[model samples]
Target: MPVRTADAALAGVRRGVGAERLTGRTALVTGSSRGMGRAAAIRLAQEGALVAVHYNRDEAAAREVVTSVEKDGGRAFAVRGELGVDGDVDGLFAVLEEDLRERTGSTDLHILVNNAGVMGGVGADEVTPEQFDRIFAVNAKAPFFLIQRALRNMPDGGRIINISSGLTRFANPDEIAYAMSKGALEQLALHFAKALGPRRITINSVAPGITRNGNPVFDIPEVVEQMAGLSAFGRVGEPEDVADVVAFLATDEARWITGSFVDATGGTLLG
Candidate 1:
């Protein structure tokens, strides 16, 4: 009966103060200015996480996300850093630490979601070395270093969730670099899970297929219909769809699962 914003979805958590699932935890979500990252950050906030919404260029959008979370009766702050650039990971942490110490009185972190990335649609024959380098820098290298740096501040039972893609399993030559980066992310999770298992920290990847990530195709009726037909549900996946999966992975209920590539593709890989 009403149009629901991301903040509206989080109102359920406001039924009672301190009734949320992650009341004392802190989460940092990269590229949270829009799309799946935005939804994931908001949902985590709904569960009572003090979310650090990170963005590169769109400071306005990042502030919007923080506002949305705050409006939902949750806590969030915006952090900025250009990913894929040198010192990006450390730069992000520096700003975040200052904010945390000022606001929460501590720089400790519990959850790290690597969601900022670049998508390349260049085919092998046409892709240049520069494009390949940029894609890997943003999609793979950034996450790797981010996790490496986060482990220091992260305590036991922390969660590291990397946003991957179902493209790794499907053959899409136009996006080969993007797919390869996701594969590398899965492998990173596989190894990191073991490395952090002693601390009870879990690392995993959530791979989604063809979700509305600022893609104009979803706006065109004919194109949307064709893409929806690809899924068993006969509908396109939304940002919230993958956000829910990422949120689950960050929760204690998903403690048993680690080093796994979860298919959040809406059964896109089923058939």
Candidate 2:
């Protein structure tokens, strides 16, 4: 279908979403209080989904995200639960159900964005059992179990996007545990793609490379240039860069894509 004119394109786009791009859908983006997850939550709301902004300890930040969404004339709410702890998933969903039902009259989730994760804990040689377990607990175990619980409420044609990293595809010894956990998460997507195909549910991983998620490391000019030089575009990624890919996956336009690793790396793998 060729889009003819500017006005026609605008009309077509508005019609596609019935309001924006994800209207009548409900999305829950974890770790949404800040960073890439926060960008995804806001993007989903802009596209017309009723967003559940999940946070760990920053209620103010979470509420701020909700406020931002509402300020843009979108609907959103906050759900708080610290991941990587026992009964964490249960507590997360308890808040999700009560809050979601109160707003939308149903607890069904159409999109689940597993963006909450941990990066650094300890170097491998200095890695203790507690360190390893905590890494996997937050990065791997939390998403694994969160999906298990979300499946009961997620209906057919639901979308599950796991936020992965470019490190999994390359050799990065510094973040070994973090990369391994993301690898495990990709495997979950591969296996579940077939497992959930019968239900028309799509699961995929979006791997980002050297993203500028408001970290102070990028604040240094030399560090910023060094990171940007790694990409073929000679630029680092922004939170919205990854969030755009994730937002596309949440829509019906990406229905054909599943069980794949989307490289949102700006050509960082071109070596």
What local lDDT does model 2 show for residue 199? Answer: 95
**Every candidate's CA RMSD:** 3.6, 5.8
lDDT of each: 0.87, 0.87
TM-score of each: 0.93, 0.92
- Residues 202-250, candidate 2: write the lDDT tens digits: 9999999988777788788777777787787777777777888999999
Error of 2 at 9 (Å): 18
Predicted model with the maximum TM-score: 1
List model 1 lDDT by residue over 1-271, tens digit each: 2222223444444332354778889999999999999989988998889999999889999999999889878999999999998989899999998988887899989999999989887888898989999999999999999999998899899999999998988889899988998899889889998888999999999998878878777778778777777776666787888888888889899999999989888778577
In model 1, which regions exceed 4 Å deviation?
Answer: 1-19
Model 2 lDDT, full chain set: 0.87
Tell me how many residue pairs clash in candidate 2: 0
